[model samples]
Target: METLANLESFIRSAEHGSFSEAARWLSLTPAAVSRNVAMLERNLGVRLFHRSTRKLTLTEAGESFRLAISDSLSGIQAAIAGIAGDGGEPAGVLKLSLAPTFGVAHILPLLPGFLERYPRIKPEWHFENRQVDLIAEGYDVAIGGGFDLSPTVVARTLAPAHVIAVASPGYMADKTPPREPADLQAFRGIVMRSLQSGRVRHWTMRDVTGREAPVRLQESFVVNDPSAMRGAALLGMGVAMLATADVLADLENGALVRLAPRWYSDAGAISMYFPSRTLLPAKTRAFIDWVVNAFEAEKLAERFAGSLDLRSSRSG
Candidate 1:
């Protein structure tokens, strides 16, 4: 029988396509991972990977072998973990991928409570701006908007991702506020260019009563990140369309003022994503529950509804 370490090393190396990356995830040296994979190939009498200077590519047999044993390996690991007392307490490195600004502003605050509850689960989080490959990158969970849900992954929405036009009070002081979404064309627009498409993004704003209008802002300034756009808007540069959850504090404190508040863009949902629920690790499950519960208790869903009046929503 092949050792579990050998199997794990081979599987991780295959998933990451680089021994160095596999080593980082597995807490082993690249040489160790390479040796383990070589040993596994020798034992099975088949070459699993095409070795090269840059990366590893799965051979035909290797792909077949991986598909055959991947699920089985997960089962075995879970079983071993159960026997080793992991089932009783969630203890492991819970790797997470989170959006930088929103993660810091909203999710980071909950870390203390989470750690207090599950002290044994050490968090290894990466703050990033892009949607991560949950399985390929080996993340336990990811929190953001607009993730492409694969067959192996599941998404639970935490709140609506509503985008609304905003501008600094100083910027708006010199101009008349737009009465409708289309009227925004007259103002200087601080807009975001799509990083994936390399084109300026446009929005169709919808009112509460279902009236939709195309909003065209004068792309006076362009950026690739939301945080930078928000900053520019705050500096009285121009109007920007930003998520309610991202600018909640700014809107609340009167640093930024909403424009055509009745009209907003539905960007999709801010969600928590993880691998399939089958054999889900205790730590991942625990963190998911904690965040969902907190969103409910705090009524963030209502607050994040861009079509609703923030002041009235809070007052009521």
Candidate 2:
């Protein structure tokens, strides 16, 4: 049988990466949390962490324990809430982190309807270009775009971008249009870094064999910001490769043109991600449902191919 105190400590510690962070959340000193975990380990007779100089990693036992405890705690919380009527209405603070462009492009704009629909639920937004771990960073929800996610954290697709190649009319005016992936090698190549790997992901196209064909980089420019890359492409700085949502307006307005040779990129869906809804607070559930509905109602399917620059003039 798991002791309730030990379970609580484990959950809190897992939710916050640092002992100090867990302590702060639990209103206990770091020493106290560490001591509690130590005793719990003694009781179980197992090592939980692989201690090292650089970073903390979980052993197999620790990983299994964490997952078990998460489910157990969720069950307990649901039971308690079942009696307390916490699931009756939406009411609480939802802490969230999101990419800057997403926050501005999708969430922030559509927030008015969500807030109006659920006045009782207040969401605190943290918009940054960095990846936020929901459990480790004390965030209730995180909006992210990537091919995959961490094992410890849970996520749902909110919005994913359709990958596409774009360049400004200003840049393409005098140059020959690229009709193939290798053709980009002759032109100045722009690169964007992946937030997950900290490595630059080459703008790749697909081959008839359904294999990834990488676009050659001529080293024209490199940038981390998708929005800025669009701007650079607009200024004729270089060929900008990004999500279709990043340049839908420019493409439509003739400021930018498609670099489609091999039918290069497709739009990726945006998804709303969180830890778990098994024992979700009413507020969080309500907001999640509302956001999903709003996403559909607003015809957000066209989010990738439309001009988001219209946002400066109108709010969607």
Candidate 3:
């Protein structure tokens, strides 16, 4: 029987297409991961990877073998954890992927309490803007919006991702505020261009009564990041459409005012994602429950929902 270490090395190497990346995720040296994979191949009497300087490509036999064992690996690990008394207390490195600004503003603040409750579990978090492949990247959990849900992953919604027009109070003070989405055309716009597509994003604003209107801003300032756009708006440059969660503090502090308060663009839901498995790691389960409970206690779901914005009640 092949050792679990050797099997794990092979599987991770295959998933990452590089021994160095596999080693990073496995917390092993590249040489160690390579040696274990070589040992596995020797025991199986079949080569699993095409060795190259750039990347390791799976051989036909390797692909077949990976398919056979990939699903079983999680179950085996879970069983081992259970036997090792993991169920009694969660203790391990919990890897997470989170959006940069949102993570720092919201989730990072929760870290103190989370660490207090689960001191044994060390958090390894990456702050990034792009969506990650949770299973292939070996992340314990990911928090973001608009991730394509794969069959192997599960998404639990934390809040509505609603985009609303906003500007610094100074900017809107001298200008007639937008009454609806179409009225937004009158103001100078701070807009975001997609880093991947290089195209300015457009939105359709909707009201509480299910009314929709296309929104096109007069692009006075173009930025690739939401944070930059918010900064520009704060400088009295132009009106910006931003996620409610991103600017909630600014709005509450009266630094920024919502334009067309009754209108918002539905971007989807901010979600916590994890691999779908028969049994999750105790650390992952604990973190998930903790976040869910925190969101509930804070009523963040309602706060992040533009359709449910408190200002909307007083707006025409």
Candidate 4:
């Protein structure tokens, strides 16, 4: 019989395509993971991976074995966890992937209360910009916008990711406010480049009446991150199009004001994602429930909406 440790090492190594990455995920040294995988291959009497200088690729036998045992491994772990007596309490590490800016500014605040309630659930959350393979990377949950909905995962919509133009109070002092999307071309625009495509994003602003107009502005500053663009706008360097959720505090405190209140870019839904499981772990279940409830309690959807006029006249 294959030891669970060896099986786990094999599974993680195959998924990550590298012993180092698998070691990181499993909290084991690379040499330890390699040793376990070697032992597994020895027991099975078949070579599991095609070893190369760069990355590990699963051999035919390895692929077949992985497919046969992946689901069973998950089942065994779940059974063991449930049978272990913390009195059904959610204990152990709960790994999560989160967006850097939004997650830090918003979701992080909820941790103190959550930890107070579920003291045994140790959160290991990574704040990043790129989409992660939740199962492969061993993340318990993810929070972000515009993630591809893979069949293995489930999503819960938290809020609408709506982008709106904003400018610092000082920057607007000498300039006439943009009444419509077209008028934005006259001002210095701080824009974001797409990290995935390596292209400058085009601004297509839509009003409340559903009229779409592309705004071409003189680029004064360009960045790849949303938080940086917001900072530039805050410094009175230029106007920027940013997610409403990101600029809510600035707009509320008069640090920044909306350019065209009715105009917004429909980015997508900000959602929380996790692997689909027949029985979710208590830690994961608790987080989902708490976050969903928190969003509702704070009226995040309404606040994140682009319908509010905090500055100049409405365009339409």
Worst lDDT 10-window in candidate 2: 307-316
Predicted model with the maximum lDDT: 1
Candidate 1 vs 3: which has more lDDT? 1
Residue 310: error of model 2 in Å?
18
Clashes of each: 0, 17, 0, 0
- In candidate 4, stretches whose alpha carbon ends up further than 4 angstroms from where it belongs are 1-85, 308-316
**Predicted structure 4: lDDT:** 0.88
Candidate 1 on 1-316: residue-level lDDT in tens?
9999999999999999999999999999999999999999999999999999988999999999999999999999998877577445787899999988799888999999999999999999999999999999999999998999899999999999999988888888868888699889999999999989999999999999999999989999999998999999999998899999999989889888888878899999999999998878888889999999999999999999997876422111
TM-score of each: 0.74, 0.64, 0.74, 0.73
User: What clash pairs does model 3 have?
Assistant: none
Residue 243 lDDT (model 1): 91
Predicted candidate 3 versus true structure: per-residue lDDT over 94-188, tens digit per residue: 99999887898889999998999999999999999899999888999999988898888899999999999998878777777778899999989
Residue-level lDDT tens digits of model 4 in 1-316: 7888899999999999999999999999999999999999998899999999999999999999999999999999998876665566877798999878888888999999999999999999998888999888999899998778789998889998888888898888877888788988898989888988988887798877789999887777889998999899999998898888888888888888888777888888899899985578888999999999999998888888875554343222
lDDT of 4 at 138: 94
Model 2 misses residue 27 by how many Å? 32
